[model samples]
Target chain A: EFIRKLWEGLLVQSKPPLTSHFPFPAQIPPDLVDKLERLALVDFRTKQGLECLEKAIRFADQLHVVDTTGIEPMDSVLEDRALYLREDTAVDGGCAEELLKLSRKTVEEYFVVPPGNIPLPKKEERSSMLKHSEL
Target chain B: MLGLTLKEVSLAFREGRISPTELCRKCLNRIKKTQHLNAYITVTDELSLTQAQESERRLQRGVPKGPLDGVPFAVKDNFCTKNVRTTCASRMLKDYVPPFNATVVQKLLDQGAVLMGKTNMDEFAMGAGSTDGAFGPVKNPWSYTEPYRTLAGPEADWVIAGGSSGGSAAAVASLTSYLALGSDTGGSTRNPGALCGVVAFKPTYGLLSRHGLIPLVNSMDVPGILTRSAGDASVVLSVLQGVDVRDSTTVPAPSSHAELPEEFDVRNLCVGIPKEYHALGLSPDTRAQWSRVADLFEAAGARVEQVSLPHTQHSIVCYHVLCHAEVASNMARFDGVEYGHRSSMDSSTEAMYATTRHEGFNDVVRGRVLSGNYFLLKQNYQHYFVKAQKVRRLICDDFRRVFASGVDVLLTPTTLTDAARYGDFTQEDNRTRSAQEDVFTQPANMSGLPAVSVPTALSSRGLPIGLQLMGKALDDHRLLAVAQWMERQVGFPSIGVHDDYRQCSDTSSTVQTSA
Candidate 1:
């Protein structure tokens, strides 16, 4: 209500109220529900349930900057976003599958080890995983 | 001449060897001889004499004021002194004298360090070289002086005394006064001290009171001292360190009284050298000197080890962002509202504010302020400002982790290269050199740790190279302990009278004739 009054005072048209219409149960993305839950983590987008979309938009720009000298915005839906959407859609292991694909592709494209390069021994990690010998 | 350290001068007054009047006269004489060095902004002759008389009478009546009693010292103009002009080396405060003394200055006065004068600096302490002062460049006092010392013609060699604290550094280097006070946010104290061949010590953040020093970057700026020796720096610091209610940042750490473990005790002392600091841009002479310093530590029975401060490489960039952001915010208070120079313009009140600031600040300060505002734009703030703050945290954590690994102190070269020609780093590529120059020093400021730069060796070109000793957070005394030991070993020669003239003229290229 405060936002509506502020927008009106600023001579701005109120954005159309978000439709309460629900998607078909069969058409719902597997990750859609999880994405809606994740939106609660973001203070601004908690009530709107739009954090997955926000990350989809923001992380895309970050990925571009890291990938192509800050140019060449990606065309296809990124695997991370797809994984987030899958988690929201409640698909079985769909998020994990998409995440694996994203990580593998990112490693291959951005961090491939170059030939004839000597790599230093990795310093000991402080993580508990290193202590437990898990995975 | 008033040839005494602040402590020594106080002792002399106690012994009746000389009066404060005589000491002030000697400082005045030195100021006259090297007037061209441009070290001072305002000389407080009357004020100094009055203070001197008070100190003398106290001594005569079997009462002594303090450790720095009857000792003359100069302050960087940025620090407010009651009823005295505190310009911050800019025109904005050219005629502005504050009604109160900065807390640090007040503390020093209460301790009896007589204020001889206010010194010159980079306008708002923005430049590395003192060339950006509203007054002008402060010539380095250690120029080559040889054959035919007295030249009447319009020819002589001269260079800058370092920047920000260049005036204070010059004063101490020439023995014009025993010690001078300056502020260092980034490399202001250490850089100028390296160039001028003096001892510059920046204590742990919040250790010294900063209530009166005009804010450059509130989080980064700390009141530091410039003196002739590490011992003197330590003595002055002893008097100054305490928790002040005025500066809320002051920590509750007790004054450092415990002596550092002897250098020979290899049982626990570990000195960590960050691999990132040994980068390619360091001068060959500087590298050799650093190796020599490391070798000395090894000989003294200390275990030296290589440590990786991965975040160290990003410290300078992060420091610039955070400092400039704070500067933008702090300097906005100077918009000619209650005091300071106000400019008249045809535009609106807001436009007048813009014009006043544009005309009031020098180019270097204006550039940083503008760049800071640009970085703080709503969309870009998260990308640059937030990232920089996060990186600053990471840099601090790196030091904490390094110290946690049992390294008591860190060693690095004070500067990437020896001091350059006056205008060498003053181009559009200033950021490249500026960032690179503070490569070794900024992390300490970021981490709020203590660091000191002491002259280690003279380069092939006759300029001094400095070695930096950085201690764990709030372990300032230990840093001084290691520095004092190193200072005694290196033993850089004191500056001579003719050196100043040689640096300012073109013909100052030859070796010293006398000595």
Candidate 2:
């Protein structure tokens, strides 16, 4: 009887299905994919990458049925408690040399990177570079 | 001695039955013998020996630090260890070493716990199965076989150690280490703990300091303790839990310590079995064990009641949205500029960032970043990210409402089924597997409640199955007490390297009478 109640609860829901109200795109459009690539600084031209994104979007569509009316968005789990703050003070600093040692390419004290405006490596070239690095 | 629990080993150390150095050597030797498990990313042989010698000297002086003194423990690779390579099982930080130890690691070291080494994990704790790691998948010690030892090729098939703390779980199960630290973000620790047959505890969110833990989802990630017993977990938790200025999220330590009572009075307890947990895809064995345990609670005078957490169905979806959003923001710091893998391409800073991320991260990590960015996009923020956050409130409220109704702790299955083969697990994408496996465990993370997965029974396949007990925020002591009672009642047989080769033909007779 207990198990039956559980099954019944699962089948007979209090809320209506909201799938029609919010029609999520079946596939992530190419332009949006390009935008995501730019925003995340990742290349998602492959089929697998696009599929993962589309699946994620489809999965998230389930939330539309949740009637979150007047619900304040919870940013942290400790929303009920007061977040303590410490007095502003420099606890640890003055280790620029040690910090600089972590980087691969450094010019004196600063990290060295190529100047802006240079184009990205081609797809084939990027793969080859990765392969070479692996070796 | 190698198979003893942390408490037992500590007791042995105090009684002079086993020296810290001898125990450390035994652990190191076991780790070496079980190399095929791929549980460790790096073995701190010299460092561990030196620490063990120091512990021996302290024992000689009768000035041991605490219960954890001289016990060997493993840290997940995601936690920073000064001068030791801290890889999140990613090529990105393959050679990168931190300048300081994680606060949890430092606390354990201060307690005189010998650090065995860093355990392998999912690349950035992103995958449900440990297979996403760059080093290799951590094979379940329960699935070890003679063929696995002889097999030289990578083509050998084996069961998976669930992730992203799969290596820690595997290490504890295999007796390579008595206790290991795993970071749980959306069931990473509990799932592996369930699969690998160990006690995995994820305390309330702010209880343990996450200062040096490589962030997966900052709000949900907590340093997980994986051990052979709940008592061991409590001991480790007592030492590790406290407020840290380094991490503002850390809460002040509770007035009482986290020690578990030898027995709990079930008559005073109300065990809530959330009906929503009886969802589809739950294995027959797991469901039976769930029912059996609920029955046991009732028979033992506890008021085992059927409760409803209506918002449970939407937790996984809500979790994915929030997890990806946080992951996208947290992962932004990994650009090749500071410390980690750098692409040779220096044509432009942007190009370097792009190619470096592409080369450093695996497909699963990149997918999350891209999807996270999409959700965070201005046009989609309100629809996706904000909606998920609102739904997250409902999920948290579900737990709050149930606990408010006088339910001491909620009992649920840690995973839908037992460990799967590597081939079977990889059949689905990382997202799907994670959604299915983490369904029951992630709700606790979403609500910031303390949850512990206790190995309760062996599946018909002879793999261990764990059940989770979740308590209200800051109620870890009672939660652990209940869990320890359940542990004593079950007497679930733990696995060892020697028992791996036994044919699992009969499930009924395989249940051990003693722990």
Candidate 3:
């Protein structure tokens, strides 16, 4: 259920780190723990990331000293300058061949990543879920 | 040859008394001689010699590149150099060579500046003691103390060169290079600069391009210049600052602005010394030095007053969260797939990624990445990452409020303490030490303000005590001008080669005896 809640939180929220939508957990679940353990947190050579995680939790409570009421959560921009987007265009500086040289497995124009164990969505289940949502 | 300032070197070259090739050879010899500082990860002997020959040819033609022509300098290894190994002092990029030069490196190259070597730094710029890098601890060139660690190994008491950019500062102070480029992600440049008696400048964010520099914190990381004098910083900053098409976040340079004024009058200036900084457990020597700087400013007809930045206590804690959060995000691309070292190659990609990171990263890097990932998780995102960002704003706002009230600049001590021993620095671990190292310097990065650390006085330990001056964001030229005025007023002594690498007389504490 905790994992489901986390998964749901990720889906519904477009802007992340929303302080509005969380009852933060005391500890990481095993699957997320396992994923973190797989991603950057190794089990053997380095211990599981519980120490850092706990430190983060403890430190997170310190911000409550200030009343953050009516203050919009700050984003990267501090100055109110208008951002002008450049027109969509490709520049010639990119040297694809040189960049490709760094790739471990490349076949002609495409990068060859190792086989990922991602499960494909079942067609019947997808249709049933879509029908239930009345889309 | 190592005694002259960079301008003096340029003058000698202009007067035809010295050739670029000769200067390069002299610098190369000095770098070779100072191998004990561990200042460089890779000294580009052939590359610098080749560049020197080209610069010499230009000089002979009577069309030199610029003021920096033939001036030897070093870039922190984090900056990529095409066909050169650019390690961020990590085993991951130990054997990895780059196919491109960082825009800043290319800029220096354009000026025909001699490239000496790539300096060593904390692994991925994560630590403050400069001890955790793969090359080992960068020794403080000013450490002329007892119980020296040189021959006794860990049992002696020698000082640190300062962190993440320790090699850069040490190289400049030791006369190995005229100037060295160090990335200041919360004091990576200035901390080392303070300890080594060099000028470290963190310019306003987006004022300098971040192209080709390895990302530490995308918002805060900019290539900082380490120089022997405040004026030298201005020269280098002028060359490095501009809009980089590759980096869109750059603040577009003004369409029409005079070249940064190398001189300014000190009269009628309002300088603020933030009161919150004094509460950070300042040492007696540091306190005296801080007061001396304020007195100098006042005597020079500038208004130096104590100002409040109430949110200062939270800045270090705030920086810790922000730095790790970004490190995790930025370093995610280093999975064993493309550029860096690939270890534990296996059929399973997930396993390969985990194993590669574990082996490639040091404990400091891994811990930061893990904590960063934990904070970024959807469930805890607001409670950690967002809260930290909000506090970051409050800190920035504190500066804005202070700057708004007739204050042209703010003054503060660059570091809480003078040079610390390697054994002492490593006691608290990287995470804790980094927070303290960044206490004063992080506010500049946090608020996107321009700050420079100029040497003011020698500490009781015979180390450099740096005084920092911060100005409003986007006013880098003005800040540099003020720093130059202060630099002239203080008249701090320069580091001489005679003082370093001497044997210690007092063997009071061993590594075992230290806390």
Which candidate has the highest TM-score of all?
2
Candidate 1 segments exceeding 4 Å error: A1-135, B1-4, B144-157, B258-268, B427-429, B497-515
- Considering lDDT, which of the candidate structures 1 and 3 is the better prediction for this target? 3
Q: Judge candidate 1 at residue B85 and give its lDDT.
A: 80
Model 1 earns a TM-score of: 0.75
Looking at model 1 chain B, report the run of 10 residues with the lowest lDDT sum. Answer: B506-515
Q: Residue by residue across B1-515, what tens digits does model 3's lDDT show?
A: 67677777888899999998998998888887777778899999999999999999999999998989999999998999988899999888997788888999999999999999999888988877677887777878776432223334534466888888989999998898999999998888989999888999998888778888999999788789898877778788888888787777777654323234556766779888776676435778887777777777777777766678888778777777788789988889898677787654454565456556766777778778877877787876887788888888888889989989989999888998888877667777676677678888988898888899989887666678998989988788788788888888888888665555544443322222110
Q: Could you tell me the TM-score of chain B in model 2?
A: 0.95
| Per-residue lDDT of candidate 2, residues B55-124 (tens digit) | 9999989999999899999999999999999999998999998999999999999999999999988899
TM-score for each candidate, following the candidate numbering: 0.75, 0.92, 0.87
Q: Write the per-residue lDDT of candidate 1 for residues A27-112, one digit (tens) a residue.
A: 22425433321211111112222332232223212211221232222111111122111123532343343333322123532422
Task: Report, to 2 decimal places, the DockQ of model 2.
Answer: 0.48
Against the native chain B, what TM-score does each candidate's chain B reach?
0.92, 0.95, 0.94
- The CAPRI class of candidate 1 is incorrect
lDDT of 3 by residue, A84-103 (tens): 34657877656878877876
Q: TM-score of model 2 relative to the true fold?
A: 0.92
For each candidate, what is the lDDT? Answer: 0.66, 0.85, 0.76
**What TM-score does candidate 3 reach?**
0.87
Best by lDDT: 2
Off by over 4 Å in 2: A1-25, A117-135, B145-157, B500-515
